[model samples]
Each structure stands twice: as structure tokens, then as C-alpha cells.
Target: MEKKVQQYYRLKQKQKDIEKELAELRQDILNYCSEQETNETEIGRYKVKLVVQNRKEYDDAKLYETLSDPEVWRLLSKSDPAKVASLTKLNVISEDKIMHTYALKTVTLLQVDKK
Candidate 1:
């Protein structure tokens, strides 16, 4: 195996072990915070928090039906930006036409480099 592959495999294994230990530590912290009647607590330099985030998922069919606007549907409906970019690269769609697309937001991904 190449050096990068070996490094990735080692880090991936460490990540799994860290995740397991993290879950256990998370539970312990949560239990302590709950018993103390608070959603946040300070431990050493880390201000641990059990934050509740609100996330909304809209259904495409129902949203389009109620709104009846093509522009609204484009923004609200679920889509894959990578697919949009792929189609654009293949000359299937114009970049100017997708300005209203909410899924056209910038994104970045991390992966192992190809040898």
C-alpha cells in the first residue's frame, strides 16, 4: 500500500476508537448536566453544551402543490448540486439558468487523493 493509504487506514481506525470513547464520554457529560438541571456546563477549558437544534425538511410534492410557483419549487425542493454541476459540465443545462436554485450553494468535500 502507498503511504497515504497507510496513513488513512491508521487514522480511520483511530477515528472509530475515538468515536466509541466519545459516545461514552458524551453520555457521562449529558447525565451530569441533566442531574445538575442545565443544558450546558463547564469542564476545564471546554464549555460543554447539549444544544437542541431545529431542522425542517420540506416535502417537494406537497410544497409545489401548495405554492404553485416554479421558482418557489426550485428553491424549496430537494436537489443535488453535484448532479447539477455534472449536467452543466455535460452541456445539458446552462449555468445562468440555475441562479435561483438553493441547491447551487457552494460546497467542499474531503477525500483521499488518487495516486
Candidate 2:
């Protein structure tokens, strides 16, 4: 009877562990899905452009900088020699770095001068 009770307790403990693991997995999946949704929204609204021929590259730091930097709008407002040079040094825009874009779009917005 003692052996049976020990076995029952062991089974209960095992079940608890499994439940905890399952809950953790579910939370991880939920977090992943939430992150994906946020990324999609950002991609749609963000102004960073991209030009790609083959597989596109993703640069998280650059993206964050571009999105967060206050100078981003100023850069976009002008496409001049000095501005281009400055942005290149800042790595805000690069020929090699392509934003998340579709196949139809090829050219990224380097600068946008007022009309």
C-alpha cells in the first residue's frame, strides 16, 4: 500500500511537471506571435525603404536606429550632396543594406527633398 501511494505521488508530480512545461511552451508561442504581429505592424508603417535583388538582409540595430532617430525626418526631407554624405557616414542609408520590401519595389528612399 505504501509502494502504491509512492507511485501515485510520483505520477502526480510528473503530471505537474508536464503541465508546467506545456504552459511555458504556450507562453513562448504567444510571445512569438505577439512579436510577429508587432513586427508586421512596424514594417507596414515604418518609412525605411529597401532595394533587393535576391534574398533580403535584416539588420535590427540599423532598423531600430532609423526608426528611433530624430534626424530620420530631416534626412528624408533632403536629397543633397551634404545630406547624402552625412547619412552614409551615419549608416542610416546604404546601398548594401536593404529594408524589408517586396519584390516589385527595388529602390529605397535615400532622400526626399521638399517640392
Q: Please give the clash total of every predicted structure, in order.
A: 0, 0
- Tens digits of per-residue lDDT for model 1 on 1-115? 6999999999999999999997787677767877998766666666666665432233445434554656644653554445545655775555565544333223222121222
Candidate lDDT (C-alpha), each: 0.57, 0.49
Residue pairs clashing in model 2 are: none
- What's the distance in Å from true for residue 31, model 1? 1.8
Task: Write one digit per residue (lDDT tens) for candidate 2, span 18-88.
Answer: 99997786566445546665322222334322222343233444444544555664554533435544665
Q: Among these predicted structures, which one has the highest lDDT?
A: 1
Question: For each candidate, C-alpha RMSD in Å?
Answer: 11.7, 19.1
Q: How high is the lDDT of residue 82 in model 2?
A: 50
